[model samples]
Target: MMMMNKPNWRLLATAAVVSAALTACGGDDGNDGNSGEDGRPGGEPATSVSTLNLKVTDASFSNGLPVFTLLATNEDDEAVVGLQGLKVNVAQLLPAGHQVVGDPTKWQFAGDDSRNGAAEIVDQKNGYYTVTFTSLDKAQLDPNFTRRLNIVSPAGTLIDGTTEVPNGQASFDYNAAGAAADYTRNIVATDSCAACHGEGNGIHHGSYVEPETCATCHDGLKAEGGRTNRSFAVLVHDVHKVAAAEDADGHIQYPTELSSCNVCHETSAPAEELAITEWGNWSAVPSKENCASCHADNNHIMEQADSSRCASCHTAEGTGVVKGTIDAHLGEWNDAAEVISQWGSDVEMAYFADTDTTTVTVSITDANGQKLAADQVLPQIKRIEVLTNLGPNYPVLSYGAGSHLDAVSNGELANNTTIVDGSFVLPITGLPYGAEGTDADTAFSFVGLAACSKGNAIVACADVADPDNTDNYTGMKANMAFVTKSGFTPSKRHTDSLEFSKCEGCHNDNWQIHKGYHSGFVMTEQVAHDEEGKVIGLDGCVTCHTPDGTYAFNNNGAWEQKLHVVHGDKNIINDCTQCHTSFNLNAFAKKGPINTGAGANPYADGLYGTPITATCASCHSYPSAIDHMTGGTFGNGVYDVDKADAQLAVSAENCFVCHAPDVADHSNVKF
Candidate 1:
C-alpha cells in the first residue's frame, strides 16, 4: 500500500522493555487495567493477557517518506511477542477548508495497492513492530495536517501461557511536520456512547472503536460499493433511526427521538448547522424523505426549492404554521414550561391501629395551599397503596385501598369514608404482625397515591416533592414513615444496595416498570401479599433470584446468569457496577442452585464450554470469583466432562490454575 512513515528500531525496543517492566510491577488497583491480584508478574504468570497497551515510539520522515515504530505490551506490562500478523492503517486529517477528492478508499488500507495484495509485518523484534512508508508525496504533506496510525494484532497470535491473545489494537496520532499544535480532532467522547455499546471496542464492527477514529474514515464519504452515505454523523443518525423503526422483542433499541438532531447535536460548536447544510447539499434538496427520518409528521417539510422558506418555520421563534424548530424538537414531556404550568398535589397523613383494622387519616391539598373540594378530588383519586416493610427474606406487604379492586390482587384496604372537609379515612385489613400488633423490630410503611386529569394517567412519580413544581400534578404523590408498633424494640429491618435515584437516571419519572405497576412508584421494602399470602416486591425479588428460590424463570437459580440474559437480550448490558454495591461485588462468589433440565439453560450456546464464571470477575475482584468456580460444581447439559473437570480444579488459594500465564480465554468468560 501507499506508505507515509518509517520505523525507528532503537526507540521501539527500549519502549517495549520499559513498558513490560513497569507492567510487571503493579500500578493501578482498579479493574480497568489490572487483571486482578493474579496479574502481578511475580505472583503468577498471567494465563493470558487480557489487555494490550500500544504506543508509538518514534516517527520521522526520511527522504520524503514517513516511518514509525510501535511497542505492544500486555496487562502485566509484559512484551507481546510473536504476533502472527499486524495491519497498519492510516487516515489523513484535512484542514477545515480542504475539499477531499478521489475515491475515499485511497485513504484506507483496503484500497492501498503498493503492498501487492499483502500487508507487511516488518522489523519484528521483542514487542516492537516497525512500519515504513516507501511512497509519500511531498505535495501531500502539510505542517498542520495530521495522520493517525491504527495497528491491529489478530487473535491467537501473541500466545501467553495456554491462552491465545484475542484481537488487540493501538491507535495514536503524529503530525507530518512534527508540530505539536497540528492535531486537533476530538469531537465526541467514546465513553458516552459506551453507556449503551459497552466500554472500549464497542458494537461498531469492532474496528471503529472510538469516535475520533470513526471521524477519520467516516468523513461523509460513501463506501465504494455501498449506496448508503458513510459519513459518521449521518450514518449514525440514520442507523439509529432504523433501530427506532420497530420494537425488537418488546424492547425499544433506540430512543423515540432519534431524528431530533439537537438531542445528539447539543455540542457548543456549529456542528448541527454544518451537518444539516451538508446533508441538504448531498441530497440536492431538503426533502421530506430526509426530514421524516426524525419527524414522523411531515408538517415541517418544505414544499418549495427556495432555501429561505426553511427559515420561516425552522427559526428560533415558531412560525404561524407550527411551533419553532427548537421548541418542537424538545420531546413532549421534557419541556420545563409545559410541566410547570400544571396543578400540583401534596399529602398529609396520621396512622392509628384498632383491634381488627389499621386506620390511616389522610388530607390532600392543591399547589395554591387550598384544601381540595370533595368533587374536585374524589374523581381523580386512582388508589392509595399501603406498603409495610418486613425483615430480610420476608416480603413487604401491600394493600390497595380503593373502590375499584382486583379480588386476586394482593390484600385490600377499604376506603372507609369519602372526602369530608378535604380529608378521608382508609382502613387496612390483614396487616402483618409488625404493622398491626407488636413486634421486636419496628416495621416501615410507604403510602403511595396518585391522581390524574380526566383522560390523563400518571405513569411515573417521584419519591420526594418536586423542587421546581414542574413535576407536580403530573400524576402521583407519596409519603413514607416508620411504623411504631406496640412493645417493639424499634430495630431497622429492610435494606438495599441500590438507590431509586439510579433507576430514575434513565427511566425518568417512569421508574416503576416491574410488578405490573405503571404508577412510577418505587416499591422499596414493601411487597404485595398475593391471595396465597406470598410476599412480593423489592425484597421478594431476592427470594426468587437466590439459589433456594428456584422458580421456573429463575434461569437455573443463578441471579447473575438470569439478569445478564434478560438485560443482554434488551441490549442494556453496559457496566455491571451500576446496580451492584462495592461490597456486593466483592462477596459475589456464592454459588446458586444448578439444574440439568432441558429448560434450565439460561445462557445461549455461545457462552458454553468456557470460563464463563470469569465474567463475574469483570466487576467482582478475581479472588472472589475463585470460590465460585471451586465450589460444588453443578451441571446442565451444556457442560461436557472436559469443561466440568477443568472448572472443578479451580480454587481460591490456587487461582492460577484457571488464570495461568498463557490463558487468554479468561476475560472471554461468558455468562
Candidate 2:
C-alpha cells in the first residue's frame, strides 16, 4: 500500500475522550433542589444537640460485611471530649436484578453501647466498621446484577456528608458484571433496533451486532452483545472506565461539555409498544434520577467498573451468561506460546488455477480427522511463516513489491514466506512481478491472521481419539497466497486504480452512497437498492449474507439481507431466475474462495467497480427530486434527520444514494 500520512494517535485519543464525555451522569431529575436528606432543603432534624459526620475509608463487598474505615469531627472542629457515645450505621442501595427475596439482613453493632443496627463511636482516630450483608443467594442475583452502597447512622440517619475523600463522595457505581458496565446496546429483537440497527440501518456505535437476532441486542436474548458494545463482560468494564477520566459528579470541564448520559442511550418513560424504550433510553439525555436508579454507590465512581459483577450473574449454570467454560477457553489462548518457523515456496508451479497468475493456495489442518474452523482457535494466534533467502538481491526485490500488494479480503499479511505450500512461484513479465528468493528483501513476506475455526475442511476426527486428550495434539497451518517482501518497490512507473488515492480518500467523499464507508469492502457488487431513491450498498445488507461481518450503515432499516439474495434481487428487477447470477462478495466475506466456478475471488476489488443505477430505481423513483424542498417534504422519509430517526431505523443517506448528483436538493448534504 502507498504511504500517505501517519495517524495522529493523540488526536484520536482526545476525540474518544470527548465522545465519552457526552454520556457520564444522567441529570438528577428526581434529586430536585428541595429533596435533601431528612426531606428538607438542608441540615438535620431541628433541635439536634450535636451533629455527627460518619465517613467510610475502606468499604468493599468482600463478604457482605463491607469493611469501612470511618472518621468523625464535631462542628467546632474540636474532638468531642466524651468521644465515646457517637452512634453509627452502614447502608447499601440494592442494585437492580439483585432483589431482596427473603428476610432482609439486619445490621448489628460491635461496641458495648451498640445495639443491633446501631453502634457507639470509641475514639477520635479513623473509625473502622465492617457491615456484613446477606450474601446474594444464587436466586436473587441475575447474572447481570448491579447494586450500590448507601451509608447511614445507627438510628437510621443518612450519612449525607460521607463522600469519597479523593472525589468527596461515599457512594460509587458498582456492577456485578465483568470489567465493563453495559455500555453499547443491541437492537435485534426490538423493531426499534431492527428499525435502525437491523439491516440497512446505521446509527449507534458503528452498528456492531452479531447473530442478527434478538440475542444480538437484548439482555434477555442470547445475551452475547447485550450490553457495552455487545459483549456484557467487556461492556461493564468500559462503562466505569469513564471514571478513569471523568469526575464523580459526571462533569467534563476540560472538554467544555457537561456529563451527558443521553449521548448514547435513549431513555424515557417507556412506551407500551414493541418499540418500547427502557430506563436506559429516556431521552437524548437522561436525568440524574434515572442514573441514581442504578449507580447508587458513590464508591463505583471514578474507578473502573468491577468485573466481579460478571461472576455474580454469569456463573456455572446460567443461560445467556458467560459460563466458566468460556472463561477457561479464553485463558488457554491467552497463555499459549507464540511459535516461529521458516518455510520455502515453489515458483514454477500453478498459483491460481490459471497459469501466469500471481497467486497460490494452501490449506491447514490439525492431527484430528475433523477440519479446523474459525470458532475453535484462540483469537490471539498471529501465525508467522518466515521465508529464507536463496538469493541476495531478491530481498530488495521482494520488499519493493510487497508494499503494493493489498489482499482486499484479509487484513495485513502476517507471514514472511511466499507461496505458502513448501513450493514457490517465480514471476513473469508484464505483471507486477519480482524475483523473491535472493535476499531478505526478496525472500521474506508477512501475512497476519485472526483466530477463525478449529476444524480443517478435510480433517474428520480428532487425533487424540479421546476428547480429553485433544489439547496435546499439534494443529497444522497453511497460507493461501504468494507473499512478497515489504522492501520491494515498483520496478517502473505505476498507478493505482484510484490514481494513488487511498481507499479512505475516495470512499469518504461519497460516504452516504456506499452506506458502509471507510470500513471493509466486501464483494457485494450484486446487492440491491431500495425502490425509493435510496443508496443501498453491500455494507448495510450483508449482515445475514456474510454472517461473519458486522455493520454500521444497514440498507432497509428492517431486515438484514445476505449478499447473494441482495445482489440477485438487484439484477432480477422482475424475473426470479436471475438470482443465480455470479455475484459473490457477500459469500466471499464469510468463506474464502474455492477455485473459480463456485468459490471466492482470491483477488477482490477495493471499490464497487460496476455501476448499477438500473437497480437504484427499484426502490427509488427515477429522476430523483428534492422532496424536502421544492415539493415541501417531497423526498423519501430519509432526507430529514428527525423524520428518518423517527421512522424505522433507516438513515438519511439511504435516501441520498440516488437523490443527490441526480436530483436538485443539497439539503441532504447539509445533514
Expressed as tens digits, the lDDT of each residue in 1-671 for candidate 1 is 10001122323343344334333322221123334233222223334567766665555556534566665667776656666556665555554334322111112222111331223456454555667765532124444566655666655644434567765655555565432223344433444444345445445554455554565555543444211244565456667777555443333344333433433332222433231212222122222333444554555454543333444345444666766554454433333213222323333323355554444445555546456654445544444555444322222221121112211111122445444565655554554544433331344444554443222333222222431132333323344333344544433323244344333323333223321242324332222322333222333343234322233432333333444454555565555444333222222222212221123333321122122343342233244353554454431112222324333532222333343221223233223
Give the per-residue lDDT digits (tens) of candidate 2, residues 328-350: 22223322111101111111213
Q: Cα RMSD for candidate 1? A: 13.2
lDDT of each: 0.40, 0.25
* Cand. 2 TM to true fold: 0.23
